[model samples]
Target: MRQMRERLGTPRAAGVAGVLFALLMAAAIILVRLALPGGADGTEITVDAGQRGAVQTALELLPFAGISFLWFMGALREQAGAGEDRFVSTVFLGSGLVFVAMLFGCGAAAGTVLDDGQPPSAFGRHYAYTLLTTYGLRMAAVFVFTASTIGRRLGVWPRPLILLGYAVGLVLLVVGADMPWSELVFPGWALIVSLHILKGHRPTDHPSPTTP
Candidate 1:
């Protein structure tokens, strides 16, 4: 009974964390994008106070977003425990950790603008978004793919959710960099998945994680 209660509690925890992560990440991305609409152009630039505050707020939210994502990931992994395939679990862990690292990397890169009290060079802006849309999205794709696989294997998620995960993962993997504001898709998908989990979409009957 205790074990069952623990399992029941995990989805709620994961859902709450995921929702928080989604909100923070999306806010940060939107703020940064709005403030620095230019993608790597080294064109002459000015950093007005409003622009500076927007970016500062965005950067400040990243650490909290990353922390929430870790919590969300941990809860999902706990629910998948014993049923998880070792190789995929490793990839899942790696992708998540790298994504978080990239988040910090981006914060540092963007921070240069505020640090020097001047507009960063074209290289700095390019480097920051490159880490985000390029590397970060790829890591996100890997994480989503693995999570979908785990959910499917454990029978914890329905077919539609699995399909949605795959579609979003593909988009992130392939077209994330080309599209403007494309990073929003990750948070959007996360919000959907979290809502599904929060709704208690999983089966009530017990099935061994190692069964299939």
Candidate 2:
């Protein structure tokens, strides 16, 4: 922890990671929404418009997986540092990547299910919907918890953004009430963090007493 405090005393990388992760998170959400049923797929427009609500709900719920994965990368970078250890860090990175990838895959799969030009079996459609929504929410929780804990230990703490993120995530989980929006809040939080990353942190030449 002391080592990281000394390394991150400048705060540049933390800000940079925050901004970059936020952009990527936003992009992931946009991409998933574009590919979903009510999105570019036009399934909802041509067929049952009521299903558009479901599709929109699914779209909102789905992208958190990718956002979570990208945020995890920032957290991982903070831990591993800009050193030779990055190769080792990647091994740990795979889990989050896979989670996000699966969400994307599920989005594509959902689009196909909706576009089949017929009413799907209640069982199969429900199953796919469940899978898509479940993973997104799970991964979002993982990212927030991971960020709050890991960021603190790394001495960067993500400042105001992370605390607000945790609160928003908690409210979404409670008020969302099994709806997929419970997961959507995290992507916006991830987006904020990513933007902070791009802006880069302002560096201070001298370290504080706590920085070892």
**lDDT for each candidate structure:** 0.87, 0.51
Cα RMSD for candidates in order: 2.0, 7.1
Candidate 1 on 142-203: residue-level lDDT in tens? 99999999999878899999999999999999998898888999999889989998998876
Model 2 regions lying over 4 Å from their true place: 1-95, 114-116, 168-177, 202-212
TM-score of each: 0.93, 0.56
Model 1, poorest ten-residue lDDT window? 203-212
lDDT of 2 by residue, 81-141 (tens): 5432343444335445655675676666555436546654444444444554566455455
Global fold similarity of model 1 (TM-score): 0.93
Give me the runs in candidate 1 sitting further than 4 Å from their true place.
1-5, 42-44, 209-212
Going through the candidates in order, what is the number of backbone clashes in each? 0, 18
